[model samples]
Target: MPKITSLAEPTQLHERILVIDILRGFALLGILLVNFTGAEIARTGRLDDEVRRLLDFLISSKFYTTFSFLFGLGFALQLLRARQRESRIVPVYLRRMVALYLIGLFHAILIWNGDVLLYYAAMGFLLILFRSLPQKLLLAFVILSLAFEFWTSLPSSPSMKISGLLPSRYTPEMEQQKELDRTLDYEKSREAWQNHTLSTRSGTYVEAVKARFQVWITGRDFLWSYFWATAFAMFLLGLYAGKKGIFHDLVRRQRLLRWTMWTTLPFAFSLNLISAYGPYVLGRFYQQIPDWGFSLLYVLAGPLGSLFYVSALLLLFVKSERWMRRLSFLRWVGRMPLSIYLMQSIIGTMVYYGYGLGMYSRLSYLVGLLLTLAVFALQIPLSRWWLSRFQFGPFEWLWRSLTYGKPQPVLVRRVRPAEPT
Candidate 1:
C-alpha cells in the first residue's frame, strides 16, 4: 500500500470501502471500448450496411460481456454498501432501480434503444425474489438459468447471409434497400442483431416491441440472469473476501491473491485474449457460443481478469504516489460515470447520425477505440476541472436530486470539515 505520509490525516469517506469508485473507474473505461462503436456506427450513421463483423465481434463478443460482468460487481458493491449503512436495503435498492428505469426509458426513446439500464432495473426486481436464498442455491439458480438461455439460443444460419440473400427491402428511399430487407426475415432475430444495418429504420411498431421487450421482459431476464451468472457470484465471493478483510488480514489476502492470480492470469493471457482473437483466426467458423457457455467463461475468465486488474490497481493506488496522481484524472471520469455515459451516447449519436457530424459505419473498431480514448481524455480533464468546483457532474446532480428529491450540492471546494475533531 502507498504510504499515507502526505495525508498524515486523510479523511475517511466511508466506514469501510472506497473500491466502488475505483472499480467503477475501470468499468467506465472498459465499457466505452464497445458502446462507442455502436453509437458511432448505428446511431450516427445512415449507412446501408455495416460490414465490419470482425470489429463487431471483438467489441460485442468480448468487451460488452466484460462491461456487464463489472456491472454485476458494482451492483454487488451497492448491496454490500447498503448492508454497512444499516438502512432499509430493499426499499433503497428498489427506489434506486426505479430511478434508473425511468432514466433508461427516456434514454432509449430519445437516444439509443440498446440501453442496459432498463434491463438492470428490471432485473433488480427479479433478483429480489432470490435475495433470501442460501448462497449455494443462489449459485445453482444462476447456473440453471444460464443453461436455459444457451439451450433456447440454438445456432441459426448467419444473419448477414440471410439478410443479404433476401429480395424484399423497404426503404422510402431506394428499391435496392427493400430487396435487402426481405432476406432478413425467417431467420432468428439474433442474426439480424449481429449484422443489422444502422440506417435500417424498423416501422414504429417494431421499434416499440423491441423497446418493450428489451426494457421489460428480455431486459429483466438478462439483468438478473447475468447478475447471478456473473456479478452476484463474484459479489458473494467478494462479500466473503470483504467480511474477512483480506487485505487487513494479510496472510488470508495473500493466499487469496495468489490463488486469484494463478487462476486468472491464464484467462487474461489465454482465454480472453483468444476470445478476442478467435474471430480473426476462426473466420466464418466462429459461430457464437451458447449463452450458458459464455456465462461460465465470464465467471471463470472475465471476473478473474477483472479481479487481477482490480488488485493491481488497488495495490498501485496504495503504494505509488505518482501512479495515483496520474490516474487521478481517470478516477474523476469514473466518479461522474452517469454524465459520461450519456454524453458519449449523445455526442456519439450526433457524430454518426444526420443531426451532427454524421460519422457512422466508416470508422473501424480500432479507430473507434482510439476515438473513444480521445473523448475520454477530454472528459478526464473536464471532469477534474468541473469537480474541482462542483460536487456532481450535471447529470449526476439531476440523478441525485431526483433520487433524493432534493437538489444536491453541486460544487466542491476547500472547506472546513463538517464534524468536530
Candidate 2:
C-alpha cells in the first residue's frame, strides 16, 4: 500500500497534485451545467424548456455524480494520510468539514439557496467508519444510502402527484405556463414584470444569507438525507484509491480506469435519453414501475457514469497534456474548490434574490446555463492566476489558518516545517 502523507504539509504543490486539480477543475466547470437549473428557478418561477431542460438532461447524465464520486476519492486520500501518520483522522477531518459547513451556511444565504457544501460538510466527515472496509462493503453502503434516497417520501405514484418530500401543489398546466413565462417575460405578465439580471449577482448578500438560514432550519420535510452518505462514500472510495497509489501509478490506474470505462461508457452515452424519457413516462402515463425503476437506476447510474467521466479525464491526463494546458484555468478553481463553490452560490443568489436584481424566475434555462458558463469561465482563470501568486486560494488560506487554530503561511515556501506536529 502507498503510505499516507500530510495534505497540510506546507510544501509547494508539485506535479502529482496537478491531475487532481485538472479533474476537479473539469468537474467544477461541468457542475455549472446543472447549477443553471437552480439559478433560473431563483430568478423566475419556471423551467422554461425547449433548450434548458435539454441542457439539464445532457448534464444530469454524469456531472453531479462525478462531483460526488470525487468527494469519496478525496476523503480516502485524507484518511490514508492520517493513518500513515498514526494520527486520529476524525479531529483533522472534522475540522476541515466544520469549515466547509460554515462556508456552506454562508454560501446558501448570500448566493444560491441551494448550496450543498454545508450539507456535504455536515455529512461528509461521517464516512470514517467505512474507511477500512473492503471495496465490496464500501460499495454496499453506497447502494443502501441511494436506495433510501430513492424510496424515501417520494410522491409514491402519479396520482399521489407529489415528487419529493415537499412536492409542489401547482397544477400541471399552471406549472407549464410558469416555465414559459420565465424567459418570455413579454408574455402575459410583461406589464408587471421587471428585469433585474445585472446587479443581483452580488448585491443582496446580507438578506440572501439571512433567508438561507431560515430555509435550512424551517424546512423539516426537506432536511437533506443522502447528501452526507453519498459524500462519505465518495471520500472513503478516494481513500482506497489513494492507498493503492492510484494517482501516482498511471499504468495501474489506467487498468482500473479501463474497467470503469467499459461499464459506464455505454450507460453515459445512452443516459441522456433514459433520463429524459424516464420522467416523461412517469409523469405522463403513471408508469410507476418504470418510474421507480428509473429512479433506482439513476443513483446507480450516477456512480457508474461518474466513473466513466473520471476515466475520460484519466485518458486526457495521460495522453493529452497539451490540451490540458489550455484548461489550466480549471486547475485553479479545482485547487480552491471550497472557495469557488461558495462563491458560485453567492453569485447566483445575488443575481436572483428578491432584495437584489430579482432575476431568479426570469432567466431561461438556456440563459441560466450561459450565465453559469460565464461565471465559471471568469472564475477558472482568476482562480488559477491567484494560486500562481499565493500558496492557497483566499478562503483556503483562512480555512487552514482557522483549522490549525493559528495563522498558517499564505505564501509559498514561507512557513518553516515545524518539528513533526
Most TM-score-accurate candidate? 2
The most accurate candidate by lDDT is: 2
Give each prediction's root-mean-square deviation over alpha carbons: 10.4, 9.3
Across 1-421, the per-residue lDDT of candidate 2 in tens digits comes to 4433465552246523777887887877777666656645533334555465565455664565567666767776666556666777777777777877777666665555566776667657666666678876766776676655566424562211133235568889967776565435334222222122222443354544544545555431233543444444455556556656777777657767777778778876565555665556456544555666666665555566667778877876677778678656577788988778767766765566666567756776667777888998899778867876888888888777767677787766555778985
Off by over 4 Å in 2: 1-12, 39-48, 83-86, 153-210, 220-223, 226-232, 277-289, 414-421
* Candidate 2 displacement at residue 249 in angstroms: 1.3
lDDT of 2: 0.63
lDDT of 1 by residue, 146-167 (tens): 4443443434422233344477
How accurate locally, in lDDT, is each candidate? 0.55, 0.63
The TM-score obtained by model 2 is 0.76
Off by over 4 Å in 1: 1-19, 38-85, 129-252, 279-304, 315-322, 413-421
